[model samples]
Target: MKGVDLLDLKKIVVFLPGRLLPADCRETKFHVSATVGFIHIVAAHDYLGILDKLRVPDDVRLYFEYRELVLPQLREAGVVVEEPDIMVAFLSEMDLPEPGSIEKLRAFVQDVGGFDLSYIMRDLQSHIVNPERSTDYYRIMEEFARVPRSIWREFKRRLVVSLEASKAGTPRRPFRFAFPMTDCTFMVASMDPDWPVIGEDGIRMRTNAVELFTQAAKYDLKTRIGVGLLISKVGDHFLLDWCLIDEPWSANAKLEDLLSTPLFGPARERVVDSYHFRGDNAEPGT
Candidate 1:
């Protein structure tokens, strides 16, 4: 399905946080005349694994239990209730090169388009000015100037490898929302909590985000589900960002806020019907 047009699908499944629907509803399915969200091309293994993991009755129940039980404890202890450090798990599992190993760093740098000091500095500047900028920005900048370029590049590459490994590794408790549809259950996996839906300016979507999702669609199509994207203004063009796929717990609230925006007014009209199902205990509502 090369160049698969999202409009071609007669019916599409939209996975939304269950909290958005009626309290008693456990499953729902409906139709929309126009696209409701960004079309992201995700790997089958990634998404299907989430679906399979979620469908297990024990896992599903345990997920809710963990949210209620462990998350608050973590928050009380000043630990963020987000995805675990799968990278640390990867490091434990494999004998990867140390961050200070220059030989391994050189190979990694070449593999990742090589090191460009100018580009790195520009990226650092962008981060420093970002509204949600990192607190360690000043320290990082100070260290960048003090350290040799090669050493700095090596450290950055190590972070990149760690992040990539984290993504590939299975989360001890994956973040996801399940919508048990009539025919099948559709799952929406959460992206990193740190990812900004809008740019630092607060209105536009980040250019890198647009490029990432668009490029992701080009690979495998077997696991491809229909696309649902959020439109954001980028310079003169409106770009797409994956929707309802942000942090699972807050996605519904985010979607609600987005729909109220002037840019999303058209999407509201296109959403024809929304249904809520309560298994066989009650009638589904439209």
Candidate 2:
């Protein structure tokens, strides 16, 4: 597999495990990235598992309540994780004017030279509402703003111990996937094998179902892929609400079977072969 591209790596770390590492660790070992990946997986699993229990046979209030309760914990975890990465990045990349310079710290936060504390806090705030629309947001923001320096102090202590262990040549385990499996699934689904054609009136229109998979030369090399999209229609426009992409094996066997049915099977074959209908302006049949 290709090494996880830097943009994707940054995207993965930005809110969750990304918040955990120091900014300086951007070039850390793939194993460290893998540990972050595992943390992300575990967090997702915990969130989803709780969501299932709170679902309670379609109680929407419980769902929102769950969100309100859990959002803070996740946000705090991200904030804590981000501090170390920011501290490391700052130490390695920039020159500090003074040991306790408030001006420099303010400039760093404002310019987003490192940690991105403001962005993370804003993102966390966006998920929950005050309902009565009072000063809760400001209060929470104030609470978080007061702690970075202290957080960094403790983090530095831990980092020293970690670095000492590293110097002693501790064996590191390898991770199987370069990027998360979900990332691979989404990337594969986003690949477009065909471009749009222009109509006589000069509007560009799509002519086929978007191709989702490509055949490999060897059978063993072929990837089994499946994706399900939940789309909503509002007025004259269609909006994609959610997407789930995964391998078409075991738990997703039903999805795999759905793709292999006569309707989709022929459409997929036509796409792979670049087959065009007989009529000049023919649209594909449903």
Candidate 3:
């Protein structure tokens, strides 16, 4: 009989018993369950290799492969719509603060007399250079200016995500597949499996899945999709459900012509990729 050699051509190591210990052990780490929201998307065509990465379900895959055969009328329906940017010079009279620091933005907000920074900037650049400066507006600006820098930072991050859609080639609405307008499916997906809750206030707080997803996609291309609020249930506390849907079609006439779209299946998987490194919103473990 040959001698049994467990180490033949294999590296040996001690198995740590601690890892196998149950959560009930005093010495074992406490596992906190939390829910996270995720967006489910599948384009009519995945020229960008996104569909492969998403591992869309067999139904979605079949739809994409044979879309032309299945729905010939939609072949010429898609159009590249561009909103050209209008150029305008700012008024020389007003001093604009660079959005480099929160304090500077605050001061600028106070000077402008309101929280409508975009509107103020628009006025500065547009033909109509002033929008009736008033004390009431100034008071409102002051009130908003008093808010902490942390809140402002989050606002800035969201603003950046919103502006990214203005870039060239960004798709506009009704991200169509074979699905009809009424076939627009809404599914709840958990984006983060281990997101922490800041106690009772987590229920009241809302997370912007679009901003988060846009930031994750690095604005390489805009997602012609919408997101519902991240909702969490009490107890076990390990799930955040997000409403996911493609862009809505405004024309009521064509809704009847749409086909059924798959909203759920094995195509969904957890994306562990972090969004922190992409931009200035550098909070870790997000």
Q: Provide TM-scores for the models.
A: 0.19, 0.19, 0.18
lDDT per model vs. reference: 0.29, 0.27, 0.26
Candidate 2, 51-75: lDDT as tens digits: 3322222222323333333434545
Tens-digit lDDT track for model 3 on 163-228? 332232232221111111223222222323243334544422324432333222211122333222
At residue 242, give the lDDT of candidate 1: 30
Give me the displacement of residue 152 in model 2, in angstroms. Answer: 25
The model with the greater lDDT, 1 or 3, is 1
Position 260, candidate 1: lDDT: 48
Residue 11 accuracy (lDDT) in model 3: 16
Question: What are the clash counts of all predictions, listed in order?
Answer: 6, 10, 12
Cα lDDT for residue 41, candidate 2: 22
Ranking by lDDT: 1, 2, 3
Higher-lDDT candidate among 1 and 2? 1
**Between which residue pairs do clashes occur in model 2?**
13-18, 19-81, 19-82, 20-81, 21-85, 22-84, 22-85, 23-85, 23-86, 24-89
Clashes of 1: 6
